[model samples]
Target: MGTVDRRSFLAWLSTGAVAAATLGRGGSLAVAEAERGATAGEVLVLRGATVFDGTGTGATADTTVVCASGRIVAVGRGLPGGLPAGARVVDCSGAFVIPGLWDAHTHSTEITPTVPALHLVHGVTGVREMRGSPATHEVRRRIERGTLAGPRMVVASNTLDGPDSRVPGATLIETDDDAREAANAARQEGADLLKVYSFLPRDQHTAIARHADRVGLPFAGHSPSLLPVHEVIRRGQRSVEHNYGMHLSTSVDAEDYFARLAALPDEPTDPNWWGRLAPLWEREAFRTYDRGRAGALAGLFAEHGAWHVPTLAVESAYARHPTRFLDDDQAQERARRWLPASLREQWRARVQAWPEWSPERAETELAYLDARLRLVADLAEDGAPVAAGTDCGSPYVFPGVAVHDELALLVRAGLSPARALRAATRDAARCAGIADAGTVVAGAHADLVVLDADPLADIGNSRAIRAVVTRGAYLGPTERQRLFDEIERAADGSEAPQPAGPAPASCCGPPPE
Candidate 1:
């Protein structure tokens, strides 16, 4: 596949307004706002906040974020100078405001209706859903029309899995012909990318990749069963959806975990987790040493330009903690109370399918889980581009809410706060093909969040959201109140207490220069 170099991509972008607009995957009414700059009549301004643009730009304080239509017209100082006479103003004086975030890797069978809560509650403006169904596009269309509130989705058609696997909702492939056919189908259906799952023959995987590239789509996902990790990456995989599948494929624990599951006479021959396996985690406990082999996967991924998406929280909540996540004070209520009913049913079934929910399961998986997390760190240190995604369909993955948890895990994996935030915003934007999101720069979309606290200080400061401005619509005191009223009219407990009050004027927290 011919890759778009960054400079040419930028040149193509600067050609015309329409060219830039075309790059935007319109979401809700915000697309219209993004096309037009913040003009006189109806602009939203966030004055005087520190910006953590996901581009590793560090933090710039005393800046103005001007929004009109829905896209940003100005960032940094001296902006909003021509704020069309009666524009709305949001004072973010003592706050940290940055681009809206993305949950880059997600897995779902059906388009659960409750994902809207994820968008509204978390500052998540977009998501890349790995496994999608017919209803998935329908849901996306509904959200695009503003009939429903949900994250802007970059959806792939479905897994082109190995022949015998019986992937739940994807278009299946058994032969190279099937892979090519599937590629055409995915391209024609407006699928942003094509995913090759485990079991696809190496030839089929390459065929799918060739077909996708020919059609201007990116091919990514699980490394096929027969192809070694390097071969898959060198073939131009845009991303690898999960972390462990490649490394653990030939390792001892893999055989024990998969082959020994049913015929297990004793615990497992692998001493991977050993005494520790019976403690912290559950089924995924054992992690044996295959340092030389595993390290190669990282190097190969880096050399081949593949990014890593670790859905650490999703796996942890569903496969490791078992019932504990449901009881987690910060997570379960949100999942149960807000997740759409249909998805909730799937969640119930998922939890039920786990191995006997015993304390031992957690023990078995703990060491491996920790090891996997260390794997994440190793990948990062090894220079692999890593991102955060919460596969919300898994048990206890409350949408929007869980990404904060995902970020926490990423930070735990040795990413600095700035880097972790970038993985969520800027890095994901680049990977998912979104333009200039995750930063506060002129000409970027005006998807902004004002935090009451500084995230770079402790990382958890991301939770201190004082206001949310999606597109050019500023969620100052009055608008938040209106949204709250609407939410309340729709249902009880829809309203979180509004922030104390608006900050000072002049967007930069002082008079405009």
Candidate 2:
């Protein structure tokens, strides 16, 4: 069988059983109810809300949704005549009901009490954590046990990198045997997926991919610098994280570009290596971007069912417009109240330490981002799935709030507001292979958000959250405010400062010049 022993294998099954048991009681009953069907005695009716339903369709105004056992049992202009006894009814007139959002490229190793609280307040009901350490595993266990308030997490094992890997706590694979063992270990650790990183040797990466397939663990994350974009997709990388290697693939001279990268030291000794190499990579990508080749690549992505999590918010924060939030009064306020002081200071330090970016170079970076945005739109238009993610936990990328900003960026890049919503909802669920989430329909999870304004009118309206529902547990405006207050308290320095967790690695190459 698998490399894991019988005892551990049985324990894994027990964990699965625990998950199933937890899904059936109290606030989690909706999950169990959805499967068997909600009866009249246990129904909750939301009346007269405009429902977008996360189907990438136009909204239906003045509609009612009947939820029972955590599933949307019915959606129509009005509810059935006489509801069941003890049925709960909520007046949702003037509100907009949509599927709960997902941040598909989160890093949960950064969890503090403040992190999950912020995410729930923002109505991000789910996340796909890109890397998982023992700390993250414990956090997930607590969330599952209902001891913590957080998004549903689908976790990848601690990232797998090669000898020259830069991420702290990463598992290094340098040989074929190492690849197999690592994949097996991740699966045994109960990871939902394997996060492959940059810097892996080609043969080692291939070995990992093969072993991952054999172990039934899907792999996603960085496109190793050693491999071409097409090769990564063809080899069954379920999704590409960020906009690095794929963006590089737009170049007609992509091979020459990679050859130049390969010639550099595997582990650059200079702290300024990022500052030195970033401008050149950007310049080459801009110079040789070929629309025909890009379209061909999009076709391949569609054929292979390879998804993309373009964490445009984090990229924009550091590259195209590093100074955008530097002086914003609201950002400053949030930084003080909601973000840990150490993390906030780290962000400011990184910014202050960077050399000046000239206006000309800044404009070039903006132009390159614009080009990549166009490519994103084109790929989705050609039926390649695109998911919205903020690369949360990265410097200056706030956990919950950045997803809303990412949606706005997606719209600005050419997606309609509905299309952008789909990226964070339906498309993100697809990316994670989560069948029960990302929609407001029969048999779906009951996670949802009630917005004060219609997001279809403008994605920015998504921030007008009136309430949030997670697994059928409702968080009204009062409750939501309490969550924010709790976060503020938790983040304040009144408590002892937590030791900084290892910084997440940048799969996206150096910041733009």
Clash totals for all candidate models: 23, 1
Top-lDDT structure, candidate number: 2
Compose the digit string of candidate 1's lDDT tens values, residues 1-513: 113333433332233332333322221111222334423234576777787767676787766665655566555553323334455666678889877878887644233334553555467777887755566666678777777665668887677765544245456676778877888887777789887775565566877888888888888776653455567788898887655354444354655534432232322244432212212212232345466555676787677767887777665664454556455676555545564444455555654444453566456455555666777777777777777777654566666766788888888878888888888887777677777676666567667778889999988888777777765555655655554445334333332221111111110001111
TM-score of each: 0.77, 0.86
Single out the weakest 10-residue window by summed lDDT for candidate 1. Answer: 504-513
Those runs of model 2 whose alpha carbons end farther than 4 Å from true positions after fitting are 1-35, 38-42, 262-267, 270-279, 320-326, 493-509
The lDDT for every candidate, in the order shown, is 0.61, 0.74
Model 1, global lDDT: 0.61
lDDT of 2 by residue, 390-465 (tens): 8887666888999998999899889999999989998898888798889876567778899999899988999999
- Compared with the true structure, model 2 gives a TM-score of 0.86
Off by over 4 Å in 1: 1-41, 79-82, 107-113, 249-296, 325-332, 357-361, 476-513
